[model samples]
Target: MSQDRDEASAGPQPAEPERGGGAATSSGPTDDDGALAPGAIPEDEVAPRSKSRWAFARELTVIVVIALVLSFLVKTFLAQPFFIPSASMESTLDIGDRIIVSKFTPQHSPLHRGDIVVFEDPKTWGSVPQHRSLLKRVVNDSLVFVGILPGGGDHVVKRIIGMPGDHVVCSLACSTKAGPLTVNGVPITEPYIDKGSVPSTTPFNITVPADKVWVMGDNRNDSADSRFHDGTSHGKLGSVPMSDITGQVVAIAWPISRIHAMKDYSNVFAKVPKP
Candidate 1:
């Protein structure tokens, strides 16, 4: 009995640990009172995460600024791309050929004869419009967006054959039957006409209206240019407005070997007779 009492009373029996669920806590600094202190984070886990987020934001901002600056530059003075879709100017510019056009020159300079130009298609050039694919658009726009790719808004490139206020006639009767175009009754020699295409077939002569030009393709037989669209003495058919002229092709930039500056028509037109 004594031994039993000694064992039981030797120390106050440890009270059964109170049964309860585990306590919820976030790792943080402990206060003097042993409670979590606010605003304290473990450096091991949170520090790296915070640093990563900050770095990511900074990088994103830098990339956005660079993109904006590049876009502005591209839209400004830099070279831009345009694709040839038709064979109207064939043998010189083929389908799938990409050319670099001079946007700045045409704005300040006069459009000269023989300048291979890209223009906003006058309703006279026909209804077709050129454009690039979605993927191509994304790539082009992401790099630099001067204008829409695939050349939106009815754009076509052709050679300028006649200038304003000139009496322009095709198939001037040569010895046999017909010859090249006659401006003011004087024959102008065209050396750039596509290799095999003849001078002219359909004949129509008209004085070009003021502030407008008569355009024709080098591939005379294969092209439907101002000559084909001209209306009879009965009515007016195809005539491009001077305002629709876009820009003259300054050079062929791509396919490096073929890269060469375009020959200005001024040299040839210098010899043409004035009305």
Candidate 2:
């Protein structure tokens, strides 16, 4: 028993290469670490693996720092990415499309009609919990910090069809023509809309409240706007206060092939009737 015990206590026995010839003691750890005393690691096995790991860590830190700095600059003065989730702006923005919403203009002045802007989500949309989508949270939260979002994601992006105190109705009947969206009392022709979408499928007749504007998506058939939330006590669902309006979407900065300034609705607003 003593002799057997002595042999067992002799520490790890040398692992001889098996007849099959691969790494010996395949189930156990290999002596690749520098801590292996002297001959445990062969001359061929010696390399600057630790130094390589340290180099990798340093490079990764630099990349992260660059990303953070760019994010700050983007949130401060320039444009940033926003992922489109719904079909509200259908032809303009499809799901998975990344749009650039600027933070500079709205910070300086009131938004003009036809400007495509991102606002804080309305109360209903603003309260949806985080973790719903990491991309949404990142874009929404970034916009919030820059004052681009109304209240978190409560903001929305739409064409300003009616300005403060404008009595805007959806349709104006015509004998031989489809009625147009009227601001004040004149018909404004919007040629930007997708041909088949009927503007304001839901009826709306309202004097845009003081200090507020009426907004709607160009893709009128599939949007939830002031008309849909008009009577709900949830408040401010249908109309966004002028103060809640944020900077406009100036361009497309991603998917490189599609980059261009977001067309201003000025052409449409040009024909709107004054009160």
Q: Best candidate per TM-score, number? A: 1
lDDT of 1: 0.68
lDDT string, candidate 1, 68-109, tens digits: 776556545544567876777878887777787776746777
- Deviation in angstroms for 108 in model 1? 0.9
lDDT of 2 by residue, 67-168 (tens): 777666776677655656677876776655567777776777667777777776665333454465888788876655653543323446676777776787
Local error of candidate 2 at residue 87 (angstroms): 1.2
TM-score for each predicted model, relative to the true structure: 0.68, 0.65
Each candidate's root-mean-square deviation in Å?
A: 8.0, 10.3
TM-score quality measure for candidate 1 = 0.68
